[model samples]
Target: MDRKILIYPRGNGEGKGNSMSMFLCLDETTLPPDTKLFVKFLLRVISQTPTKSDDFEFKVENHFGPSCLNWGAQKFMSIVKLNDPKKGYLVGDTCIAEANVTLIGEVTTAS
Candidate 1:
């Protein structure tokens, strides 16, 4: 299967903080006709501050195809502090996120 990585900047609370959203896009065209794909993954995020790593990990599974998968609203973590500079999450600070995906199996349906 083909994979695509995507990232975007997201703001919260009128300068209270900033966050990054990461997504994985899988190309559906690569799958065989009438086949369904299932995928699962664990996501991790790391910030500049050693102890400030994201407090959560994500695990998800869904039908694989030309769709974008990412963390939901309750899972998104603030990676930057735009309103405060002393917090170490400065404007130019960088955060790293990763996703480990596993393909459980593929099934073909009868029409």
Candidate 2:
């Protein structure tokens, strides 16, 4: 299965202008009709600091299908926190993001 991580630097929808938004998206076009995938995933904004303790992260478990191809947090992290130099989320005009996905199961409907 193929997946993608979407990041809204200025946020998206409700989080716009206030926070960062992140989403995990399943490529529904690659899947057969009526197929659902159960997945567990972690999304993170890695810290550049040596300690790495200030990394911002979130975890989600969900079923992805054609009807709902994406899922995630609209208010992932406050822009203030992400922009704060002490937080180490951004360094040298670059931001590092990571995603880990594990497929738990698959469901196919009989039609």
Candidate 3:
């Protein structure tokens, strides 16, 4: 099934906050079946500069399990994927977050 990705972040100086909005694109088939993975994909794409590595990067955190200990932010940085380089979504959550968010064709990754 195709999923609509959604993310909300609060930070930075207004006029440019949206520039830092994170984006994630998963190759659909990578996600496991019958299982809901609560993950946050943080992406920092350099639109105008055209650089290889970002000056900053967004973080995707997934929460799962009873204690939700497995889905901490520590695992996020290592798992997030950028569209330009196109690494695809990386899943490593042993726990699910309280957020059961569905992606809705975001402005960031839709390009």
TM-scores of the candidates are: 0.58, 0.94, 0.25
Residue by residue across 73-108, what tens digits does model 2's lDDT show? 999999998899988998878889989999999999
| Residue lDDT tens for model 1, 1-111 | 766655554633332245545556666667666676778766655434556643345467776632433233332455543224454344365545566778888777757
**Residue-wise C-alpha lDDT for candidate 3, range 1-91, written one tens digit per residue:** 2333233232223313332223333434644433444555444423222342333344556533223322212212222322223432212
lDDT of 3 at 4: 32
* Evaluation by lDDT, superior candidate among 2 and 3: 2
Better of 1 and 2 by TM-score: 2
Off by over 4 Å in 3: 4-35, 38-40, 53-55, 63-111
Rank by lDDT (best first) = 2, 1, 3
> Best by TM-score, which number?
2
Please give the clash total of every predicted structure, in order. Answer: 0, 0, 13
lDDT of each: 0.54, 0.91, 0.32
Each prediction's RMSD to truth: 4.9, 1.0, 15.4
